[model samples]
Target chain A: MTKLMIKEREVVVPGDIIAEGMNYLPSTGTYRQGQHIMASRMGIMRLEGKVVKIIPLAGKYLPRRGDVIIGKIIDVNIMAWRVETNSAYSAMLSVKDGTSSFVRRGADLTRIYAIGDYIITKIINVTSQKLVDLTMRGPGLKKLDGGRIIKVTPTKVPRIIGKEGSMVVMIKSLTNCDIMVGQNGIVWIKGEPKDEILAVETIRKIEDESHVSGLTDKIKNFLESAKR
Target chain B: MAYKKRSDGRKFDELRPIEAKLGVIARADGSAYFKIGNTEAYAAVYGPRDLYPRFLQNPEKGVLRCSYGMMAFAGSGDRVRPGPSRRSTEISTVTQRALSPVIDLDEFPNAVVDVYIQLSQTDAGSRCAGICAASMALADAGIVMKDMVAAVAVGKIDKTMIVDLDYEEEAFEGEVADIPIAIIPSSGEYTLLQMDGRIEKEDLMKALELGKEVCKKIVKIQRETIRENFKRSEK
Candidate 1:
């Protein structure tokens, strides 16, 4: 027998009863305690067939494979550069993965990616112990120049991009600013100061309203109205 | 004279009017304020981030650290000292232990989650109030937890066992026994139980039963406030 105590998309906090009985399986942000399935974190519930999972709305970034992220260089060494990936785990960008071309064994790593510089990179690997490795050998992977950075809830990154990059692309076109959003929640915006502010404001709006439907039209209307 | 009437005129099963607010500290990963009657506590949660002093790092999972202190003017008696005392240290250790069971930190290797609790005012049951606030802050910080914790002070004042013991009742000139307890509501597990003074076995059991019911009420407030926090941020 299966009985669900909550609705399909209800917001739940830790220990909230999602369902009872053994017919449904708990997954992701949920766990099974005896016959009861409870939420283990705060998030929105998603019911897929017989599986009940919760999509977390807030948390620090956790490294994952193949996700392009923005990280700040924290240290420089002979073998690699330590990068803060906006996560609990610090990642390493080895000399081999630091650049496409290399000359010698020992070179000044700071010249490539200094401790204070920010770069767009991709996570190539993350060990079970959460040792992360980063690479700069892909397109759009490079050091970012001077720009203003803002942080958002990491879980909202997907919504900030929207379906097929429509939401972000719309903001880029509307504000006439360059913007890059990291999956880890660090956003870099570069343009006129006013344009940068507008971009930041619009992105935050998207983050706040991500759960609401008809978001694209609402954001478009907001941007248009703010411009006038 | 027998304990005829509650000095505060509250029912034996009644608790102080509680007020809770979430995310009050913007810079902390999670923060909350909890006030029960005249007692108030503020708790902030930080990390799941790197822990320093390389020697203290745990390779298997994250460590939870807690610091509890009261302001100099927060005491019902003499002023509290400005630093960690024996009593504060004891409460901090117990608070850390009380909140540890529900949190799953295995996903964060070589990391630490720090909970800092401060009491701005006190009546009695400051430790219980601190535990309640810390639990809410931990959950608000998005820490994965199996369940939520709720804490309250329950004790026997002479022949009457009350749900929440205030400062006056604690100092009553009769046989008084004060017990502060924290519980994981979903499973009815006791994570914290400490008592001062003495009680018979049957009386203690009855007081603990009242404790469980009071904890349920505290959990209800915690759950509603946590959900309300998200709803407020949605706009």
Candidate 2:
């Protein structure tokens, strides 16, 4: 018989048996051993249909291919611009992949993307050696300007966006701020000074209360109050 | 044989009071400050970040580096040197070994996780406490692991097997074995085992058993601290 050993939303530590039978598939933050599925990190257990996953409360981001992320240009070389992906691995944005417009060989690459500029890019590839390749040739992918950047836990990025973009859209409409969330936990907000500050506070609140139930209603109430 | 009871009045199998706190350092990815009786230690975990020097980077797994140090005033004697001494280096090696088994290093390639442990006040079982605190710090950092490691020192004092020896008991000379053991409580697999001084083989077995039992209790406290940290963050 299939059995779930842990209650949904319960906190579990490493090696705690989350499920006892193979009927349950283990996802991220968990591993399988014999007939048991055990948590591999300290986090809250999330049960979704047949999948048992753990949502870690804190950790550094590890980049994956095809994720849209905000990165800082740290170094510029002949062939590519090195982008720090808010992770241990640095991604390379080659001059060819950097822009749709092509130019002569050995053209100055720094002028296109200068150091310390934050850009939204998509991960094109991640080699087995952890060499990450990034591309900026997509819609809404380019250098960010005249916006303030704020950081939250990478794991909370999904919560800030909410289900089907409901939460983020609410915050943007209420505060009149244009917000862009990076999968790597960096958020860019641009608006009038007062509205930008309000957006930042609302985002922080969502991050702090992401694990609690009824958070969507609570955040909505908070935004309504802030509007006044 | 009747023997003089310990000055602190603990029974042969009794352990010192434990107090542990997680995420004590705001700047660190994970941190813990804990006290076992008079022995106070702080451990901080940083990274899964880039490994420096390039050569030490493990392509297949992350490197775990531990630096164990003692404050100059931690000891009872004259002012101790304020750097990594021979004793500190050895302790650091053992601490790293004790914690490495639990961490899933393969999850982050070319990364290095650094655990820094400072014993600000030491009784006798400081190394054991350091291991416990370091493991909690790793958990706080959200590092994936197979299990959490708990450790304790069991030594023969006055021909009696005592759990968690203090400074006064450890100062006893000759024939008294001080065996420190760290284990994954759920799996019962030992990650670290070291013995100083000689004891009968049978007594060594007894000490190992006692050490494992006490480690379970410590593990419970570590888990509670981690849970409390997450609960507070929820607000």
Best by lDDT: 1
Give the runs in model 2 whose Cα sits over 4 Å from its true position.
A1-3, A21-23
Model 1 misplaced stretches (Cα beyond 4 Å): none
Per-residue alpha-carbon lDDT of model 1 for A1-228, expressed as tens digits?
A: 679999987788899999989999999999998899999998899999999999887678889999999999999888899999888888999988989877387877787888989999999999988999999999999999998889998988998888999989999999988999999999999988999999999998988877777899999999999889
Scanning candidate 1 chain A in windows of ten residues, the lowest lDDT window is: A100-109
Which digits, one per residue and each the tens of the lDDT, describe model 1 over residues B73-153?
999668789788899999999999999999999999889999999999999999999999999999888899999899999
What is the total number of backbone clashes in candidate 2?
A: 0
TM-score of chain B taken alone, candidate 2: 0.95
Residue A13's C-alpha lDDT in candidate 1? 88
Q: Model 1: which residue pairs collide?
A: none
TM-score for chain A in each prediction: 0.95, 0.94
Candidate 2 structure quality by residue, lDDT tens digits, A38-137:
8889889998999999999888888888889999999999889999988778999998899888757888887788999999999999888788999998
Q: Model 2 misses residue A61 by how many Å?
A: 0.9
Error of 1 at A146 (Å): 1.9
